[model samples]
Target: MKIVIQRCSRASVTVEGQVTGEIGTGLMVLVGVTQEDTEKDAKFLADKVAGLRIFEDEDGKMNRSVLEIGGKVLSISQFTLYGDARKGRRPSFIAAARPEQAIGLYEAFNEAVKAHGLEVQTGVFGADMQVELVNSGPVTILLDSRE
Candidate 1:
């Protein structure tokens, strides 16, 4: 499991010119699942993301978690995080999980995030989506279950 977490003041996803999921003041999470990913990996990431202290506190120090700031989450399925292009002009997606297996884990990850008592929005799985966001501080974090 791998995730790219971007802190944002607002974010939204659109499919076929229709808005699917939208949020104000939150994290835009791009998630990727590999063949080895399981519910345990999902759970670990959910906990880590929810408690991550990326938001700034009153003193301008990054000391607050999203929950503390009453922020939301916009989760998107992004298998391309596993793309490998080191050896060729074209990238290989062999590390990405098959759609059937990935969908389940993706849903599980969202559920795990919701278990933290924070609002969670999502993009349509397997759909072509256009995501927009105002990145707050441009703060971004990368997480990998294997690490």
Candidate 2:
């Protein structure tokens, strides 16, 4: 599992010109799953994202976790994160997990995040979606379960 976590002032996802998920002062997460990903991986990344301290403190230090600052999460399934382009003009998506396998883990990840007492909004899996976000601090982090 690979997660691209972005601290955002606001974010939303649209499908077929209709807003599907939206948030304010939260994390905009792009979640990717590979063939080896499992339920454990989802749980691990969920815990990490919820606890990650990217937001600023009173002293302007990055000391506040999203959970502490009452932030929401806008999660979108993004299999293309695994795309490999080193060999050709077009990227290869062979490393991405099959939809049958990924959707389960993706839902598990959302559920685990919700269990941490934070609101978790999500875009429809396998849908053609558009995401918009105001990246606060432009702060971003990449998490990999295997690592």
Candidate 3:
């Protein structure tokens, strides 16, 4: 499991001109589930994302976790995070999990987040969606479950 986490002031996902999910100050998680990912991987990644201390604190220091700041989450399933581009101009997506498996893990991940007591929003799985976000502080982090 790999996740690209971006702090955002606000974000929204729209499918077929209808808004699906949106959030206020929180993390925009581009979640990717690989063939090797398990339910434990999803749970572990959810805990990691929930406790990450990237948000600023009283002294203006990045010492507060998203949970402390009363933030929400916008999680989008993104298989392209596993795209292997070392070969040629064309990137190979063979490393990505099959849609059937990926969708299950994606839904599980969101459930895990809600289980952590935070509001969670999500994009439609396997849909052509438009995501809009106001990236806050440009504060971003990359996380991998294997790491």
Model 1, 110: alpha-carbon shift in Å? 0.2
- Please list the C-alpha lDDT of all candidates, in the order they appear: 0.97, 0.97, 0.93
Model 2, span 68-138: residue lDDT tens: 99999999999999999999699999999999999999999999999999999999999999999999999
Q: Write the per-residue lDDT of candidate 1 for residues 45-65, one digit (tens) a residue.
A: 999989999999999999999
> Could you give me the TM-score of model 3 versus the true structure?
0.98
Best of the two (2, 3) by TM-score: 2
TM per candidate: 0.99, 0.99, 0.98
Which regions of candidate 2 deviate over 4 angstroms? Answer: none
Predicted structure 1, TM vs. truth: 0.99
Instruction: List candidate 1 segments past 4 Å from native.
Output: none
Q: What is candidate 3's lDDT per residue for 60-109, written digit by digit as tens? A: 99998889999999999889999999998999999889999999999999
Clashing residue pairs, candidate 2?
Answer: none
In candidate 3, which residue ranges exceed 4 Å CA deviation? none
Model 3 / residue 49 / CA error / Å: 1.1
* Pairs that clash in candidate 3: none
